[model samples]
Target: MTQYLAKYFALHRKLVLPGIGFFNTSTQPAQLEFVEKTLHAPVHTINFWQDENVADNNFISFLIKETGLNHYETINKFSQFITGLKEKLQSGVALKIPGLGILTNNENGYSFNPENLQQYFPGITAERVIRQNAQHSVRVGEDEKTSVEMHEMLNKEVVKDRWWIGAIVLAVVGVAAILYYYLSR
Candidate 1:
């Protein structure tokens, strides 16, 4: 029965046990670590809440379909399983839901400790590669521009700032020419 619940939770990413609460699975997308130069794998996390008021219609329907049992039988079987879980929790035994995590009844409420399944997923080395002259799309405000175009625009601004250097060189050349001509004469 625990296996069925775990299988259903794995397939649907959600489960709502009528008398207990709800379980939900959320995924964090793979991320690139700039400092480590590695691409981390995506992570799937399960969360549980001990709200007795939550509905379990979808879970009941899924169980009915998977177990080949009628609605009443399915509900009965599921309730029996939940009753066992509740009894264990009430007796101070932590319930370990396979493939999910451990659940314990704390002073406040039910506390869930999710299993660390990261050992099954591995990350790969992914170094950042940026080509200097490579043309790529870049978003600048509301407009899209290419890398090469932006590079040229930036260089033009730099050239404008250094315009005085060219003027100073021409002035020095003119002064040398004038001195040479007067000395020759």
Candidate 2:
């Protein structure tokens, strides 16, 4: 029963335990830390909301199929289970759902603390690798160009801009040579 509930929540990423609360799983995408040069792994968080109006029709149907029980029997069994949990919660006992989290009745209302998934899903150390001279497609405005082609084009422009400097140096060297020849003669 608990295992089936956990399995259903895992598969659907959402679960509604009637008269209690609803659970939802949200994903935080992996991020790159530029200064640290590390890529952080994505995280999946299970959030519990105390919404009493959440419908459990789909969940009941799922349990019926999984438990191989008729709809009325399944409902009766699940209602009994929920009633037991409610009784314990009202008596100031924290209920821990296996593979889920701890649910406690607080001064404010029902408070839920999610399980730490890091133990089951450990983060791996991922480092960013950048190739300096690698040729890859890049979008330049609306046109696609190879990185090598762009590098060549940029280098050509640099050389073209500095052509006058080389010409001036050569002219100075030629004038010095002419001066030496004329003085020697």
Candidate 3:
């Protein structure tokens, strides 16, 4: 079951270890780190969501196929695997999965101890852009632009970004509907 989980994690959208925790992937966008003074390329990273034994969208579907078991059987097997993993985590054992991470649970919270999986973000190989001239600053003082103005600018950018995202989503949805319509016809 653990090996099946490993394959599922490698191939699927999400993994649910019922009663343990949920795992999902998220993008850490390419951004400028002020403290580090480096522009990091976007990276895909796994996040551990502390959730109940409740099912998620992709968990059971992957399990059904990977385990080659019926829905009820897969669920039962998944539940057992999760119970073991939780026990291991609570007992201070770091459960390690390749390409994923070691998971450890302390008194306060459970954490996924990912082992350097960010070395490569799948399908994205943006070169880390660096500045040769490390020392440079544009101090936007109150005289040039007030904090309120800067905030307003940021708000406008947010709205613009939201509009673009909405447009893209609608476009995708529209295309999907059209394809479905034509295919069904």
List the candidates' TM-scores in order.
Answer: 0.65, 0.66, 0.52
Off by over 4 Å in 3: 29-41, 120-185
What local distance difference test score does each model get?
0.86, 0.86, 0.72
**Per-residue lDDT of 1-185 in model 1, one digit per residue for the tens?**
88888898888888887667888988999988888988888998888888988886887888888889999998898888888888888888999899889989878878899887676788888866777677889999999999888888877844347888899999999999999999999
Over 63-132, each residue of candidate 3 has an lDDT whose tens digit, in order, gives 7976688999977877787788878887899888766787888886777866566566333334567755
lDDT of 3 at 132: 52
Worst 10 residues of 2 by lDDT: 118-127
Per-residue lDDT tens digits of candidate 2, residues 1-185? 78888999988999898887899899998777777666667788889989776777988999999999999999999999888888999999998887789999988879999987757765555666788888899899999999998998877844347778899999999999999999999
Summed backbone clashes in each candidate are: 0, 0, 0
* lDDT ranking, high to low: 2, 1, 3
Better of 1 and 3 by TM-score: 1
Candidate 2 regions off by >4 Å?
Answer: 127-185
